[model samples]
Target: MTPSQLRSRIKDENFCKNIISYLENIIKEDLSWINPAFEHLISVSSDMESTIFGSVSNCIEDKENTKHNLSDEDKGEQEYFYSGKM
Candidate 1:
């Protein structure tokens, strides 16, 4: 799948939130090492921003597919939860 599709899938699965949470947890424990990482981040921000924006735009354009993917995933999760298989 395209990068945009992968991003949309991640968003639909709430993967980004989990990843952000994980990153926050890591940074909270090691505040001192964040500077070099933050510096590299700033340097890459511009290029990454365009890629992200493009992916979001693709997601928007294929919103119906994204919605279907999300709904089906939700259904699967719900079924698994109800069946005690989660």
Candidate 2:
């Protein structure tokens, strides 16, 4: 799923809790069958890592390209700044 979808899913407290509970149960049950579980876990983790890193790299590239294309005056604009009120 995309980041937005993931964000929406995470916003639901019950869904998040259920996911945590499910994962905990899986770990508890799989602890005895280390071989198969370890292989599956490693495969899932590697895929996730690749997806996350690719997204991050794309974001960084986009930001850099935007910066290069901006005028000197626009470059000085604050994209992010602290709100003292908070």
Candidate 3:
């Protein structure tokens, strides 16, 4: 027997955007979410070392992906923060 079709991810750009916005609102409401939009951030640690960030050309260029970018002059990296944003 052979498969009749291929499985795929959600391709609706607008629908996906709505879902993401909904999720973002949920996290911001009850959780300790942090970012430029939040005031819950702590000061950088004294022992924290500088870091070099890698470029995310794919996500930055992909129109279907969430439209946001988070970067710092020092350390690089979260999605829930994606490791860097988090």
Pick the TM-score winner: 2
What order do you get sorting by TM-score, best first? 2, 1, 3
TM-score of each: 0.26, 0.46, 0.25
Better of 2 and 3 by TM-score: 2
What is the model-wide C-alpha lDDT for candidate 1? 0.79
Task: For candidate 3, write residues 1-86 as lDDT tens digits.
Answer: 12332112235677568778988998779543446444423334322322212134555556235344435522243334446544
Which parts of model 2 are misplaced by more than 4 Å? 1-32, 71-73, 78-86
lDDT of 2 by residue, 1-86 (tens): 89899889998999899989999997778456568869988999999999999999998899877877877666556343223332
TM-score of predicted structure 2: 0.46
Best by lDDT, which number? Answer: 2
Runs of candidate 1 with Cα error greater than 4 angstroms are 1-43, 64-86
Task: Count clashing residue pairs in model 1.
Answer: 0
Candidate 2 lDDT (Cα, 0 to 1): 0.81
What local lDDT does model 1 show for residue 84? 89
